[model samples]
Target chain A: MAVPPTTSRTAAELATQPACWRRAADAVPATEGLPRPGERVAVTGCGTSWFMAQAYAALREAAGEGETDAFAASEFPTARRYDRVVAITRSGTTTEVLDLLAALRGTAPLLALTADPATPVRDAADALAVLDWADEESVVQTRFATTALALLRAALPGGREAVLRAADEAATAVAEPLPAALLSASQWSFLGRGWAYGVAQEAALKMREAAGAWTEAYPSMEYRHGPVAIAGAGRVTWAFGPVPGGLEEAVTAAGGTFVHAPSDPLAELVRAQRVAVAVAEARGLDPDRPRGLTRSVVLGV
Target chain B: MAVPPTTSRTAAELATQPACWRRAADAVPATEGLPRPGERVAVTGCGTSWFMAQAYAALREAAGEGETDAFAASEFPTARRYDRVVAITRSGTTTEVLDLLAALRGTAPLLALTADPATPVRDAADALAVLDWADEESVVQTRFATTALALLRAALPGGREAVLRAADEAATAVAEPLPAALLSASQWSFLGRGWAYGVAQEAALKMREAAGAWTEAYPSMEYRHGPVAIAGAGRVTWAFGPVPGGLEEAVTAAGGTFVHAPSDPLAELVRAQRVAVAVAEARGLDPDRPRGLTRSVVLGV
Candidate 1:
């Protein structure tokens, strides 16, 4: 039997993130469907998109924009009122997203950010921000999720400059090699603080989705409570943004490799994506088509 | 050199769950600080407590009691207004809980559930529910967290009957021995839908804390997306509450051990707690004192 293609589409998609993010950042003004400064907002999605919603919610709230909440689409609180509700879906056809949008139609203004503008989400949403260029061929999503978030970040105060800088860093992150020791670690734990906690969760998800790695994620401060027990000589503890005070020492004392890079968390996530692909390749697995996964989930209710 | 006591306090405390739950159910009437029906609520905690908050939040919303949200104490959206905010901490002195309570003092009504009534949280919260009898000697929490949730559950409509039935089932769960293959599994994945997702997260945390095991948790339907790639011959996939359609078949097809007990999720959680202790005992690790963990976290700001 012949081996399949060596170059995964996930790798190709991941490599294009820096460029996609740059375009997303530049496209923010035209993407006017996002929540405004003082609007109470709820963001919803599924899987990786849900994780990105969490990151945006934390970032939006921390930036003093307004009260922002993120929820998994299936678990969204329908009774709650928000000034605006934003749904993020790479594929506009996800059942949960469509159902939620239909349920929320006349209640509040509904906005959706999707890679496909030609789907039912466009009709469901009152307004739409489409990033068709960021769509992926891989079952494992990489660029679309981050690109959507980049667009959201750009719309915030002081976010545009930061995102532009991070886009450059992401290019470097994709080109540079992942730490060999981390790639070979027996287990991986990702940690983040504030908005970065969402980044950490997404990074861990990327590793599991793209590489089938044994990975976990938690808030940096919560690591010492119990999750740190899993840290050992062959494990990796990667912090997405600023390491909480004394966390590096604790990870080192637990005999685990502590990794922190002075770059935007979004850029750090790009690095983690690269590592996931590299590790998957090393294990003779294709990152593009992860085992038993699809580009979009359309469940029959 | 002498090895300390082999019997774990966590094991002993876990065994007391059924009784503690009964007491909690009976005590719910006196627990005046719980959120009223139709009130928007936010629950906050750290570590094990946070997972319980997630479960309670899901249950509360699912019951149509109100829109309830749960957050790790540090991540609570202070800018958001809720009819009430509930903080759960086994030890009342956790810095994040104290800080959050202090921040929310004049904003709205604050309630706290803690095992230790004497701590500063007593003053920080506007109202308090103390369960001193449920306190634990073990650094790894078991009964105290579940017992607190039991009290919350009992306060909800029809929750008393459910709790009573679950208590009876919990007694059976604690007595039944966990599967030998599951106890020896190399990796574990826990899945739950809705409120059970929080139980799944807590179960995974218990395994990581008590046994230093590699564990992961996800919403049951979302498990097939990518995380199931980690499932294999030596891995375990345990589901709390009803197994989602096709999930059992998927897990079996992946060559992973599939575990689902037809019992209350809270009762299932008790079983998971037992599994954590059993795995710890097999590994010759002390569940009472997980490596580098304390009963409570008090960080200096």
Candidate 2:
């Protein structure tokens, strides 16, 4: 069987995540472009990058680090003044990010984390932190997004230890084969709490991108509100982080498989990434170049 | 054939939206609990209410009223100081809203809009705006949520005219039958731009709640980045507002039905609500009592 390029490339990139996370943690001090402890900040990105921004913003705010807001690049409120604006783009050339950075030039300090330092984002941003080592050959991003998140997480108080521990767990998680039932499930719902809500959204996006799978995500507490109606036999409800009391029982009663492993939320995301690749291979799809998608969206201005 | 109580109630409530909206618009002066023109505000809610909060926040900020943020009630950053915090809950007894209001009791002026003024939220809030007439007997909310939004929109500059126009369009929308193809589509993607993104998200939630349909929502521009991969035959892509350049062509190219009608975005949402009910009736599901859900979540403290 010919292994698709996307499968092999995505797997290889995912496997390097532990080391990438460690490097990102170590590089935090040199990366002065990140937001200061008390600075009000807005983080913008596209696709997977935007989801990571959401996680970082939630985490930063939860840590009492000051106000941090996340927005899809196109939706960033230019009228709002922030102490700093951080852009996360692996390709470093997403049209919206560049346009936003250009528009905000001289108005506020701008920082960007990208895998490609050679791209125009280097010029658009006032400062840049390049994670070239985490760059992927596949169009479906994995290492770069996680590594960028790891870099941001490390900047938070006590985040270094958490990132290191999560990296170690991710190393183990990437090795374990995805559950057959999970891969074969007719539908999936990824649930999370706090910062992990963004992780859940990204996990759902990964499944849709890599395998065209039917997937949904929601804040754990909000799942029972309406989304649970879709939960039943042949569906999987995967939770990241601790869930509200009785959630597991509720999912079970609804006839859905409830998956909650004792791992860091970020580590659980790594496992989800692995499942996406496995499902893609199983479905005979090329995740590296998903249908009707490009690595970077550089629309004509 | 006897109509399910949920369907009939939901339909009746949805049909009253035009009147509800008009009343809300007229009551803008009496709605003293709403955010002021330049006040930095945070709006919080859960489930359907949260989506409406999102729509209102975007609309408020876009109208250049002030910096507005929307958060799920459970995730609101208590540490951040806001000039005002607006809580939306039809039942007025959702535990998260009550807890949040309690937490911010002395810190910031808190406003709550609820259909049930008799509930605990009335006491928890610093001020209250009651939309008792918009309350629903059905577990699945339709009128109350949109009516609350209409109330907020009316407070914005020039919003009265827009609301009146949308209310008129909604009246026509509720009377029209849903598209045959939309009712039968195996999957659906609701897309929106700017403030309408929240409407799309709400529409997708409505489908999941009312019909247990597989649905997704995304910012219209971001859909092509990865989500469009899921678009294909038997799927529908429904846009709430004017789509970005080339989006319709892209959805069609991916073999999905692209739905865009010339109507106010809020009016378009009324059409979506009608479709959800129709689809639920076709699937023999009682939308008003969706599985594993309640009208409001009141977790024990």
In model 1, the clashing pairs are none
Question: What DockQ, between 0 and 1, does each candidate earn?
Answer: 0.62, 0.76
lDDT of 1 by residue, B12-33 (tens): 8888999999999999878877
User: Looking at model 1, what is the TM-score of chain A?
Assistant: 0.97
Q: List the residue pairs that clash in candidate 2.
A: none
Per lDDT, the best of the predicted structures is 2
How big is the positional error of residue B163 in model 2, measured in Å on the Cα after superposition? 0.6
Candidate 1 TM-score versus the reference: 0.95
* Candidate 1 residue-wise lDDT at B80: 82
For model 2, state the Cα shift of residue B147 in Å: 0.3
After the best TM-score superposition of candidate 2, give how far the Cα of residue A49 lies from its true spot, in angstroms. Answer: 0.3
Stretches of candidate 1 exceeding 4 Å from the true structure: A1-6, B1-6
